[model samples]
Target: MTKAPHRRGADRTEAIMRTTLELGQEIGYARLSMEGVAARAGAGKQTIYRRWSSKGALLLDSLLSLHEPALDYPDTGDVVADLRTQIHAAVDLLAGPPFGPLFTALIGEAQYDPRVAAALNERLIAPQAAKTVERLQAARDRGQLSEAFDLDLAMAILSGPLYFQLLITQEPLTHAYVDRVLDALFTGLGPISRAAGR
Candidate 1:
């Protein structure tokens, strides 16, 4: 049976996104082009252009699509542990092959391209930050975090160092590093009694 035109269009869009990420990983984002993606995806330039106006928009969607399925903010009763797990998972995702290099490229490109920056902020950064904020707010409501705890600062404290390691220092994002950072931040946020195991 022939697929409907809209269904076929959806399939083509998926193929384009998938091919874009694969090419981004192989050639690096600095060299990736919509023409290349269209060729690799088995779609015409017009098809890709119809869906995405620029490589930045297409690449942003590709990155978001790649990470969204695996991204989750855990709430395992222990806020500290949950945050650690989330951070560790994120580090693993961003430090591993394909995604690691791709994300690094995206960050670098974002520094110079306003379109990429805006797309990244809207599609990736804002959403993840909101999730972190939501988790911290939940912890506060449960008395795990003090009312005075600044959720925004907490989110930055959680993510900023990891990004620094990923982009600037190029240090290993280890479990120990995540734990140490979390411990230091939690120390200033107030102590939590684990007697009830929450």
Candidate 2:
């Protein structure tokens, strides 16, 4: 007879995820291990390994849980305002404690580990990019953007500077910086037709 899958309570799962994020922030993704997570979470090693195949998987789950709530696309009819809100939310999530350092570590580790790269891309990057694309598409449909606007390129342009400031320049991602980025992008992308006279 086949054995039934083991199910853990939500409390236990939250404990594990909380522990993983804490350790990830403190020690970083490269130094994080399932053993350490299990120990810190007050669970057995097999308990963690049984639930997650690797450290990357565990960390990915924790990261997603922490930041998923803020990943929604805002549809307030003003493309510039929506983009600003989205970008600001992203900066808040990725520039604050626990998530920020954990994200930085995962991104750094992903440079050398394909598994981490894939997980981060799939769980975090791709979804947020898709949301941005959707928002841009909506703007295009509403005649706020040029018909020939490239969504992929738009998303890259919108997000690239934030990541650059976050990871490369190590500069503060302030509100003024967000507004400047939006201003520059909107200037090149053309005026917001729908939001005129406001």
Candidate 3:
């Protein structure tokens, strides 16, 4: 669908993005359009064009903005507990409105659009996921982890079950699931040993 003109470049772009996500939530991405976002955002067409220049770019920012900074990975001293916290954070995000359906729709769209794939990877994957990798690296360096640790495998183990429960089973990601998943993953991951009574 065609969107009306946007407000202006920077502020306009953000406004459009804000409006786009709102519209996306109200009406599924299938029905999304620049016009709807612009109208709702009170932006101008030229405003959006100046910043993004393409629907993919605009949509990318729109989707990315949903990630609040606090949602990013936390580097707690205890990796297992940290991983559990991260998993629970994901569940909390999925269980909420706009993120689950919005991200799911974006994932489906990414399959057909290479740009979307790259954008998704850059915005969502890199920041939070890379932090996990960094944490794993730290664990390895401290000799707390097995030499055979596969980072990719480790991350998958930490996150896979949660995704299975939330994405596949479409079940609620309760605290129980979080605890269970973390326990299973930690058993295989091999967290660093702690001193007694430390």
Residue-wise lDDT of candidate 3 within 25-126, one digit each (tens)?
888878887767767877777666676645656677876664553665566677777766776776666656656776666666777888877887787766
Model 2 lDDT tens row, 42-81: 9999988887777877887887875574668779999999
User: Candidates' lDDT values, in order?
Assistant: 0.83, 0.81, 0.70
Worst 10 residues of 1 by lDDT: 189-198
Largest lDDT belongs to which candidate?
1
Those runs of model 2 whose alpha carbons end farther than 4 Å from true positions after fitting are: 1-11, 25-31, 191-198
> What is the TM-score of candidate 3?
0.75
Name the better of 2 and 3 by lDDT. Answer: 2
Q: Of the candidates shown, which would achieve the greatest TM-score relative to the real structure?
A: 1
Clashing pairs in 1: none
Give candidate 3's error at residue 51 in angstroms.
Answer: 4.8
Instruction: Tell me which residue pairs clash in candidate 2.
Output: none
**Scored by Cα lDDT, where does model 3 land?**
0.70
